[model samples]
Target: MGGGHTGASERASARATERARSTRLNAAEKEKDERQKNSPNATKAIAEGMNVISTTSLKRKRSVMKQFRGKESIFKRPEALPPRFKNKDVPDYHKHPHKWVRYTLGDVSPEDMSDQSNTAAALSFLRELKERKELIDTNNIELEVPPETL
Candidate 1:
């Protein structure tokens, strides 16, 4: 008799658990349906709120910009300031001269003089300068002065 009573209690507990689960499921389904029905209204409210916020922000920004625009000095600078440096009549050499020197290793082409390296290219350049009498060898020059002249 005790075993039968325990068995009946177990079956009643299982049925109670199942009924609670079904009630929860039904509540979840009702909530979902309510949300689906009210979603359009919620979205409309959110969109209207966003539009109001954006328009207020835009108006505030416009007002700030207008304040900044009005803060410009009333006394404007004269437009005729001797035309500055634009029309100051530069010389022909300053405007457009011939030779433009770039003292860089990359500027010296190895193919032009068939130079193997940058040092060789520089040496060849110095040699050309010496041939043209532009580079004077000052290393051999010795300063000599008479003792009485000092």
Candidate 2:
């Protein structure tokens, strides 16, 4: 009788484990189906510009921020489709509207010398200066130039 009871308990335990596993699998399948149904519409709307991603992203960000209080987002920045800068001739489309002044390095002041055109000059100057002073430290270097000098 004890042996029969042990056998029955083992069978019951096995049955419970199988049922739990099946339940978990079913839940996972349901979630996948829900995602599939929702994803198509989301993608279509995004493609059509009918759906702006910012709201959804903001919502997700808010939820995530709440979850971690002040943690940084884990999602990698999406690669921007190379700016359709309508005019590719306009060098940097990424700069802000207010930063229109363009300057090469050394065009204005040593500080502004790091601007795109002046980079070579700035580098050459630094290299020459470094050669003249074997123990020169870069930490003391300071730049004083307005952004518009270019």
Candidate 3:
């Protein structure tokens, strides 16, 4: 009986030692910086994730009113181009362009913008500038689209 108790204690001690070693190893792994492990791939992943929601897919959004305002032009013409802005004029109620920079996802820094969750920093920065009354809205007028009065 004495020999059996010693053998059981030895087995328990061995298991305790193994458990301690495993716990220490896991701690060491966790101590390593998360940024280091994810590195460059992490940045790329974040950018790709952000692009999944931006302007590139804007055309896919559906508009409720598809009725033509007038008869279509008979002559075949080239597609209308996006608005041309040689110099973008913001409002006095808005932030100066210099104060607010555009941070494209995959090409921008989170430090410049407020949201750490997504690459919406550029938009956030613009809104903040406008809120601060640093921008002027002469060339930066907002157009009101009248709702369809059914």
Best by lDDT: 2
lDDT of 1 by residue, 1-150 (tens): 799999999999988987876776568567655764465554564778745334544464465446335443335777765545755687666667665443666775657656367578699899998876633444323234445766
lDDT of each: 0.62, 0.63, 0.56
Prediction-by-prediction clash tally? 0, 5, 10
Poorest 10 consecutive residues of model 1 by lDDT?
134-143
Q: Write the per-residue lDDT of candidate 2 for residues 59-128, one digit (tens) a residue.
A: 6446544644543333466897887666766556355656676556544664654477578778899999
Task: Give all TM-scores, in the order shown.
Answer: 0.27, 0.28, 0.25
Q: What's the CA RMSD for each of the models? A: 27.3, 23.6, 37.1
Q: Model 3 over residues 67-126: C-alpha lDDT tens digits?
A: 223534324778899887846866644756676766658765656555554457567887
**Candidate 3: where are CA atoms >4 Å away?**
33-150
Over all chains combined, what TM-score does candidate 1 have? Answer: 0.27
Which residue pairs collide in model 2, if any?
Answer: 102-150, 103-150, 104-118, 105-118, 106-113
